[model samples]
Target: MCGKPTARPGRGRPPVYCSRSCQARAYRRRRQPLPAPGSPPAPRPTDVRARQRRRIAEAVWRIAAEQGLDAASMRRIAAEARVSLRVVQYHFDSKHALMVDALRLLHEENERLAQGRIPYDMTEPGALLRAVLDEFLPLDEQRAFALRVFTAYYARSLTDPVLAEVFLAAEQPLERLVADIIGVGEAAGSTAPGIDRVHEADLLVSGAVGLGLDVLHGRRSLADVRTVLEYHLGRIFPDAIPTSRPNPA
Candidate 1:
């Protein structure tokens, strides 16, 4: 900026600007990479890519939920997502890769949203654990859609090794999280003594999954499932207390 020779600092990166004022000016210029004033903003390459990818994944989820996985061909997914077949092919090498990525994104999104929905005032381990576990059920429209998609993929995974790998990869970690919370509740004297949290986690998680499927199949009512869960909770933690929360449905 000054057009004057400034000696480089010994043994360090060379300066881009001669002085702090020059550095600030350069920063201001770089900060305006998008547009000047109020002209229509330019869509960033990375943002557009992410949006497209998410759109494709969401298309997979919706189709799997409403229709069936059989309907989610590459061409169909591209049409559903409003992208070209070439774009879908470009992002995912094959339909299997696309389905796997969509499942992975679904799990990541479920975990993020579930954690975010936890009550900030829920300091109790039992309460937090219940909150987390409740996410597995098809209680409301959002969770119902999620569980619907999950169940469809799970059924497909039974015969597809690639899909099985994806399911198994994410399953154990979630069980461990539940067991850890149960252990905390036990240590805090809010749960029954001498409980094997790992075993409990396995049974609890498996049972919840089974019940969720039942609910999805219309074999059980939402209230009935909640009642069953509460009964089981009472059996497991006689001293555990309840917290005021929104309807799980």
Candidate 2:
């Protein structure tokens, strides 16, 4: 394991040891039998279950996005996933249960993508806030598909109490996060003075989502949405410069 430099070989055989001590150590290691590693770790029941659940949820996402929420029936989901109906039932007991699980998984996936794009220790809270807002745009197919399905779920939530509960559960926490970021920027003197953090955050966050939905439905171009947000964000931070950093993933 010592990474010391070794003597060069004379073009015939390779030399691995630079000195007698290393040679001795290598020899001893070669002679001594290593303990058997046994077998690779088996998949835990929970892990297998989670994986199965994820596959089913992704099927739901695709079907919901391409067709509609009403089309994502339990049997259709099973067929889309190429699994038996019983297997789908085993993983998700009912269509309502499946829809909830799929929505949660979608949020987890969206968070994972944003986390990957934004560094955890990004120093500038303003930059962090900007990135978070930018993520709502449908800059690429993956996000566009996600937003499409999410909009369908949102419409369904209007009549479905269960779905509305899921949406509300996530919305408050997200608004609080955006507000916290704005609070940090305000403390750093980067944001406009005398602004209410929670109020500003609510407007910015909801506005971004509203813009995204419009863009998703072809009512407004993505560029137009960007321009509008830029104007608003510039007003909030007059001293800050705006950059069009499109994440086309």
Off by over 4 Å in 2: 1-42, 120-122, 244-249
Task: Give the Cα lDDT of each candidate.
Answer: 0.81, 0.81
Candidate 2 residue-wise lDDT, 221-248, digit = tens: 8888888877877767766668757633
Q: What TM-score goes with each of the models?
A: 0.78, 0.78
- Model 1, 8-47: lDDT tens digits are 9898887766655455545655766655798876788679
- Candidate 1 Cα misplacement greater than 4 A, ranges: 1-41, 120-122, 243-249
What is the clash count of model 1?
Answer: 0
